[model samples]
Target: MRISLSTLGCPDWDLDTICTTAADNGFDGVDFRGYREEIDVTQHPQFTDRLVETMARLADAGLTVSGLSTSIRICFADKREENLAEARRYIPLAHELGVDTIRVFGVGDAEEHSLEELARVGGETVRDILALDGAADLRWLVETHDNWTSSADCRLLLDELPDDNTGILWDVGHTTRLGGESPAETLDAIGDRIEYVHVKDAVYAPDDENAKDDGWVFVLPGEGELPIDDALRELDDRGYDGWVVHEHEKRWQPYVADPEVAYPAFAEWYRTVLE
Candidate 1:
């Protein structure tokens, strides 16, 4: 198993600082969500013109790339061109960075379409993206988020895609916190398709002013009500050897703990809990 840091945790950190902090915090890779305020990082200079230099710096920091998270929505018919374009942009960059997996999300009007129907269209969108030049070899993973948090529900999309290269990027936080599914239950449903994971902790803090819209507040891993230990044990028992990414959403919630505090703490927790 490997541990990595999501740049979403340190939204304001420059690429150089991201590398240094990840290396110092015992992370094996840094998952690039974006840099500074740029959500579409392919448009950012570090990934565009300075790619070679960027790769050298990441190598100097002794890091591997976990993956890239994209805001591509596969189920939205309105965003089909946008989805394919994002894939087109990312494929070459992914080839350069040696990243094999890219994260994506799915969306649909539930009132108008069944989950299976949404997944069908979403699968076609993914297939179209994969048909783009340099995309066949890369894996596109739909995250367990929003409407797709339930493993069974997510499997509708996973089942719709080609089995060889598509799968789920399981976000444990959402499955437990919002989807109301236990770690064991989630694994039982889609464990085989789980090639990547997002690890975070949260508690029902409905009364807290700082709580998220869902009445839950994010917390350091192993410190909240989430089943971090159970999740790890379940994965280990199943011979799962995927990246465990600490997805601290500092970009979305500016008030959260800084990556400097959260990253190392996750590393420490990962060590102690596993031991």
Candidate 2:
């Protein structure tokens, strides 16, 4: 399997720094969750007007564009047109960047709507996006996040779409920590639909008031309670050779180690444990 780091880890780094640092750290690719201060890469000049140069820079660094993670949430009831527009805007950008997958979210409050409602709406939204021109060459990945962290819940969304162009971005951290699923159980449910993976580790820290409502505190891989090793082994057993993206999430959670520290740590740990 190949390894990549998401720009979410290095939200302060420019394109040049991102490429060079990724190359120096032994990462095979860079997934663009954000660039510098801009979370939406589609609107960033380096990716819009200066795309060719950006591509050349990555190639020179012996790195590829793994994928683009967008803020588009398909399951939201109030943002149907906005969600579709975001997908339309990013799908072509993904194709232009020669990246195969665009990450989206199935985010909604379960109290507001049932899982069935979210899955149905999210599935139809992704299907509409896939039907757009030039979307055939791209894959839309719904991340295992928010209300869809459980593989069983994700399977509900996948069952509605039933298209090869749509798949899951298996976020091992969420599935194991939040959804209370074992690696084998998650793979058994949604293995066939997993086209990409996001890896992070964290521990339930009830003492830290800043911890998430569920008391989860982000930690470097192998230091936390997440069963990432088991998940990676399962992927290997299934003959899955897709991108395993280290999502440091420094952009959203600034308390975590900087990408400078976290990126190499992940590269080394990943190699030590999985390579």
Candidate 3:
């Protein structure tokens, strides 16, 4: 399996810093969630007019562009145009960077609409995007997040989609801690469709008011309570050779361990797993 660093881990780092740091830390690739202060990297210059320069920088460091995480909400029918517009902008960028996988959000709130309704709308919206020219060349993985953390609930959306080209970004932390799924159980439901993965770990701090999923706080990989090794084992046994990205999420939680600390920590943990 290939290991990569999500730029979510280092929100403040520029392209050069990202490439050098990732190569130094033993990462195979860098997944662009954003660059520097810009969260929507499609609009960023590194991905636009200067894309060739960016690609050369990554290649010089023996890195690939693993994935791109976008804020496009696939399940929200109300923002259909916004979602399609986002797709139009990034589809070409994806092709130029040789990044075949991208992350989108299928995060539908149960309060806003029924699962069936969300799935129906999401299916239509995603199909529309996929039908666009050059879109079929790339895979769009809807992140396992928000109200759609549970793989079973996620199936309602996944089933509506076509094939492997559209799937889930199985965030182990959310599915296990928030969705209450064992790794085996999650694979049982959507293993075939898991084109990419986000590797995060957290401790169950049920009393900490600021913690997510009722106190499951994000921590450096292998340091917190989540089943880092078991999850990797399950993926290996199932023949998942896709990118397993260390999503440190410093963009959202600025107080967490810095990428310099967290990225190598994840790499060291993966080495132990291989042993």
Candidate 4:
């Protein structure tokens, strides 16, 4: 499995710094979640107007643009047009950058809508986005997050979009810690549809100031209780050869360890354990 790092970890790093750090640290690819203070790559000048230069820079650094991580939530009722527009905007950019996958989410809240409703909305949105031009060349991945963390719940959305171009971004941390599903069970349910993987580690710490509502605090890989090894073993057993992205979410949870420290640690651990 190839290892990649998400820009979500280095919100403070500019494009040059990002590519240099990724290359120097032995990352095979760089997943763009954000750059500097901008959260949307589509709106970022480096991607929109200066794409050729950006691609050249990455090539010079010996890194590939693994994927573009977008905040397009398909399961929300009020964001249908917004989400579709976001997908339409990114498809061509992804094609230009030679990226085959773009990460999206099914961010449904159970209190706001039933699982069935979320599935219906998310399915329709994804279908519409997939129908757009240039979308067929790229994979649109729905991550295991929010109400769709459970493999069973994720299956509802996956069943609706049977297109081969649409697949799951299996976030092992969410499935194990949040959805209460083992790596084996999650793989059993949606392993065939997984096109990408987001690897992170955390422990239940309600008392910690940085703890999310689930009482989980992000930690460097191999430093917490996420079943990362088991998940990687399962992926290996299945002959999965996709990118294993280290999703250090320092963009959202600022109190976590700096990316400068956490990113290299993950690279070393990943090589030691999986390479």
Please, what is the TM-score per model?
0.98, 0.96, 0.96, 0.96
Full-model lDDT, candidate 2: 0.88
Per TM-score, the best of the predicted structures is 1
Model 4 TM-score (2 dp): 0.96
Q: Which pairs in model 4 have colliding backbones?
A: none
Q: What lDDT would each prediction earn against the true structure?
A: 0.89, 0.88, 0.88, 0.89
Clashing pairs in 2: none
Better of 1 and 4 by TM-score: 1
83-114 in candidate 3: lDDT tens per residue?
99999988998898888897899866679899
lDDT score, candidate 4: 0.89
| Candidate 3 lDDT score at position 200 | 87
- What are the RMSD figures for all models against the true structure? 1.0, 1.3, 1.3, 1.3
Candidate 1, residues 1-275, lDDT tens digits: the string is: 89999989998889888898889988999899988889888999999999999999999999999899999999887788989889989999999999999999987777898988898888899888988998888988989987798887888788789887788999988898888889999999899899998999887899998898989888888889999889988898899998999999999977778888999899999988888
Give the distance in Å from residue 212's predicted Cα in candidate 4 to where it truly belongs: 1.5
Those runs of model 1 whose alpha carbons end farther than 4 Å from true positions after fitting are none
Q: Output the TM-score of candidate 3.
A: 0.96
Off by over 4 Å in 4: none
Steric collisions counted per model: 0, 0, 0, 0
Model 4, C-alpha of 144: deviation from truth (Å):
0.3
Better of 3 and 4 by lDDT: 4
The per-residue C-alpha lDDT of model 3 at residue 249 equals: 86
- Clash total of candidate 3: 0
